[model samples]
Target: MSARSQRPGFGWAAPATVFFVAFGILPIAIVAYLSLTRWNGLGSPEWAGLENWRALPDDPDALNGIKVTFLLTLLCWLIQTPVSLLLGVWSAGRQRSRAILSTVFFLPLLLSTTAIALTWLSFLDPNFGLAASLGGSSLLSSPHQALYAVAFVIAWQFVPFHTLLYQAAARQIPTSMYEDAELAGANTLRQFFAITLPQLRNTIIASSVLIVVGSLTYFESILLLTGGGPGTATRVLPLHMYIKGFVGFDMGFASALAVLLVAVGTLLSVLIVRSTGYYRMASDREGFL
Candidate 1:
């Protein structure tokens, strides 16, 4: 082969490569370094080796944060995925009602996260808020109810995005398949179970990866809604990291948590991709899974 032909296409990839190195690789390298040292964002970092990492196992608040983070991840998967799938399936058909319903379902995504959190915060406020009329304590003030309420808000905001994903995937299925299923004496529910769900497996897997990773990093809404209040009841890993780094002035420990969060998210994503046979199906363009 000619030298010219053997030359890699650096011209085409240079921009993206530069961006990845500058923004992605550089920040991660900094974080990795900071995770090994004690620095309170202002002073010179003092080398601490593995001290911060070792402390994670014995840290009660950190342990609780991990538990809460995983709980939120599971709750989001269970609640958002199914509901999004149903909405997507129902809206895949061209109907006026479906269009209206999809619009209503997606309206929440239009608002900012701060707005959504604050709105829910008001609704859950016991004094002069909507929940006041419910005649009991505010849900946000209750440790048991706070986490679930926050999870619901997160799911509500993102469900539309997931629904759009599934809707697009579902719509790509050939109409002939449904016709064949109808001719085979399949009912609507039977068709969905045999065909629609099967066809959407890859989409579901992909969406689940996004949701799981997002759940791990959810912070803003939680911060605004509950401030990880009611005594750490709703504090997730990201929120805990923020508190450690900024609020508590424990940057080293916070960096360790951040690294762990990234590691966990990456691990889960890889497992999902592999277990779902995503790599094997990647080259298939026919789209009929």
Candidate 2:
């Protein structure tokens, strides 16, 4: 007689599980199998065993990619978190101005990643873009600035998404907590740290995990913008893998790199969830129930 009992059984989940297996597990398995063999999409895959994995240690681009990947992740976190958090918090206010401004702020989320990257690429074009107006200097082509340029663009494309996350999370925080803090002589800044920060803790952890993991897979934007150029200054792991796989036709080595990236992304996610106690945190709604 219970409503829970009326719900369909595991049959409803079958479609999702099938889709995941077909798209997710299947490709990973194919890639794992390819990692042990040499192929250039010319003929049948030849068995190369651990040759590709062994070569990773000696590959200069792979090493540089690891370094650059970490650096980008750090920069992205440094840039996106504070800005998104502040914007999200400010927008959570029930005001017409905040609503209108937040709508404009989140408009970037409507654009595709490729569109954003290409648009910025034009702006950074040395000959006729925004750079031409400034000093004919292109950040995308600068050895010292290309990485930062890429980071800025990445932030520009994704900050709206993460800000949406924070905004929703901030809204879920009880308003009564702030009212109580105000009654206790706590100023606005004091209330934020005591009430807002603590409440948004889980959202922050979830967003950080997403940002860090997503940083590992940012190939298209970098490809469209810098092409990992300016003397390998912006070639992260995914881009390097892409070059080896698609550009050089070295499928075997590329598969190995892909496996390594998958492993790292998985491990990093696990570590963050465990360390932050995010998995153990319970929902406020569940407490009410």
Best by lDDT: 2
Tens digits of per-residue lDDT for model 2, 69-156: 9999999999999999999999999998999999999999999989999999999998999998998878877888999999999999
Model 2 misplaced regions, further than 4 Å:
1-9, 284-289
Worst 10 residues of 1 by lDDT: 280-289
lDDT of 1 by residue, 1-289 (tens): 2467877787889999999999988988889899999898786999999999999999999999999999999999999999999988888999888898889988997999999999988888889888899886788889999988998989889999999999999998788888888998999999999888887878998899999988989999999999998999999999999999999899999999999998999899999899889866653324442
lDDT of 2: 0.91
* TM-score (C-alpha, index-matched) for candidate 2: 0.93
